[model samples]
Target: MNAVSTTSAERVRADLVRARSARSARESLIKGLLFLAALLSVATTTAIVVTLLQQTISFFGEVSPLAYFAGTKWTPLLSGDQQSFGVLPLLWGTFYLTGIGLLVAVPCGLLAAIYLAEFAKPKVRKTVKPILELLAGMPTIIFGYFALTFVTPVILRDVFGIPVSEFNGLAAGLVLGLLVTPTIASVAEDAMRSVPQSLREGAYGLGAGRLQVALRVVFPAALSGIVAALILGASRAIGETVIILIAGGQSPSMSLNPTGSFQSMASFIAATARGDIPQGTLKYETIFVVGFTLFCVTLLLNAVSTRVVSRYRQVYE
Candidate 1:
């Protein structure tokens, strides 16, 4: 009987050890998979950067850096007419569109986030959030069409009584802004929700009014997150292609007017690539150079956002 009892105890111990070993193995597998995924993402980004740099260097070899930077004209097809590929116009157009888009997105998105997070009932929020998310998921080309066919012509002709141009940066930027608002709202709302309940309670304990607590305590605490969200939205606006391609004119004008037609870097690339430019041609390589510029701009924005978020991060007990 003693031997049988000892045997049963040993079996139970063995089973427990085996179960722990299996769990550890599963955890290790999951961690390894995640690590590999992260590594792959980094590798892909690095490859893209390297490829763009290589192509850009080749393009600069054919076209002088001075001409690319200083000259105003951008006639890649005409070699004898003193063609200039000054990137400033394209860069300015990008910023102009991005600024306009952000101007529209930030206020609307932040307000929506405030309502959803602080004011809305659960049922209302549940319905609204999904609908907003659906808007985000809609294809950019669809938004481009909406901007071109519906918004621009209607508003410009009907409201302003002006002949609407086929391409308008303001319309594109506005549509892009609408598209990005949901993303900002979702991020900002999550950030706001992450505020500690203790902070709110403390404000209440001090006899603070609801608006005072929200403005003074909550908003300040969440400012870092809100800034990060805005930065991300800006990044999206900068990288947007389809809406700009359809609504923003192909002309890389240096105009800052919201109503004027302009081309973003992404839109320019899309337009250029659509032409039958031979592979290994100057124009072909220029696309890579533009892409490289776009990538660097977005990277810088992300880095700034990261620094700002870190600097202003709030600590709570």
Candidate 2:
């Protein structure tokens, strides 16, 4: 009996050891994969930065930095007298479209978020939210076509009597606004929904109306996330290529008019990249210079978003 009992105890100890060892091996494999994923991400970013810097350095050798930045004309692809490297027009068009997009997106998106988070019933919220988010998944080219074929001619020209060109920024800006609205609405709604229920109840106890509570308490509490969403939408608008290329046209304009034809940095990069331009040319290097500038701007916006979220994000127990 003593020998049998000792044998059973030994078997149990061996089984436990084997189980733990197997678990440890699986954990080790998962940890290694996670580390590799992180390393790959870092390596990819570093590679992009290095490539951009190399090409941009080459570009600046031919073009002065002062001329590239300060000059108001952007005709690098043109010949002789028409070849100016001023990036301001592209920058202006980019921000002008972005501004128009924000004008349409912010109020509509915030209102939708507020309605979904604070006013809507569960069924309504579920149905509406999914439908709204589906806009983000639609192909951008489709949006461009819609703006060109429908919004520009029928809506802007016929209905509104706006003297928009066949390809103009206003229509593109409106559609771009529609494209980024889902992002803001979704993110801002999530932020507002995450606010503690007790806070809402406390506001109600103070006889605060639903609108007042939503605008005052919840909006303020979720401001960090809302701002982050806004920045993200702006980034998306800035990076949009196809819509702007198709609807906004390729005309680089120094004027900040949304009703006329304009070219954005993204549109310029997209249009130029598809051509048969030879490598090592000044025109080819312009792509990388503009791309690097865009990358820096986006990186700065992301940094600001991170700072804002870290500073003001409310932590609820």
lDDT, candidate 2, residue 293? 94
TM-score of candidate 1 versus the correct structure, residues matched by position: 0.86
Which 10-residue span in candidate 1 carries the lowest summed lDDT? 73-82
| Candidate 2, RMSD to the unseen true structure | 3.4
- TM-scores, one per candidate: 0.86, 0.90
Candidate 1 clash pair list: none
State model 1's lDDT: 0.87
Per residue, candidate 2 scores C-alpha lDDT tens digits across 1-317 of 99999999999999999999999999999999999999998999999999999999999998999999998999998899989999999999999998998999999999989999999999999998888888778899999999999999999999999998998989999999999999899989988999999999999999999888999999999899889989999999999999999999998997756788999999999999977889899989999999999999999999999999999999999
How far in Å is the alpha carbon of 211 misplaced in model 2?
1.3
| Residue-level error in angstroms, candidate 2, position 273 | 0.3
lDDT of 1 by residue, 1-317 (tens): 99999999999999999999999999999999999999998999899989999999999988889888786666565576666678888888888888888898999999898888777899999999888888878899998999899879897768877665778788988888988999999898888878998888899999998777777778788999999999999999999999999988788787656677888889989988976788998778889988998999999999999999999999776
